[model samples]
Target: MKLLRWTPLALALLAGAGTASAQDKPDPNLARNLAATCAGCHGTGGRTVPGSAVEPLAGADSAVLMQKLRDFRSGARPATIMHQISKGYTEAQLELIAAYFAARK
Candidate 1:
């Protein structure tokens, strides 16, 4: 009888914990490491070199960055390399990469 009475309370607490964890900020190290692959072309922290044709990604909107990455992964946006490269990462990883670049100066 006691176990049954506590079950709902336990479930609610577990659910709340899950929600709180989900709301926590992502690990910066994870995002940085995942985004490292982009450094070769996008420059360190996604800041393109001066006079480069490549668009600077630093401080770009995360939504825009994520959309571009998704397009590359999906082949909806044609690219010389991004299409193939983007295919290597899962959508969640790509979002992390996007957030990493967006947060950069």
Candidate 2:
């Protein structure tokens, strides 16, 4: 009876799990290039730099990351470092960067 009960529960869980991955599609090329600038703080190969003051961005969400970049570009989020860097980027470049990081696994 225990084995029979467990089978139904496991099948339900497996069905639910499949839907979660359906929405997680990411672009490959963008993720690769965006990695360059990200490496400055987050470390190369998506690893966080040891004892670095900056927070790691290895697996951050794409939409959230894009909005942050947009905010930095617009002077809405006011970080001196980000403000300076964001100013140098074009809108296209920003999109590419956002797409790249968002694609990270």
lDDT of 1 by residue, 1-82 (tens): 9999999999999999999997796664898898888889989889889999888899999999999988988889989999
TM-score on alpha carbons, each prediction: 0.72, 0.56
lDDT of each: 0.90, 0.71
| Colliding pairs, model 2 | 30-100, 31-100
Q: What's the CA error at residue 38 for candidate 2, in Å?
A: 3.4
* Per-candidate RMSD, Å: 6.2, 14.0
In candidate 1, which residue pairs clash?
none
Error of 2 at 49 (Å): 2.4
Task: State the lDDT of candidate 2 residue by residue for 36-62, as single tens digits.
Answer: 876776676456767877666656676
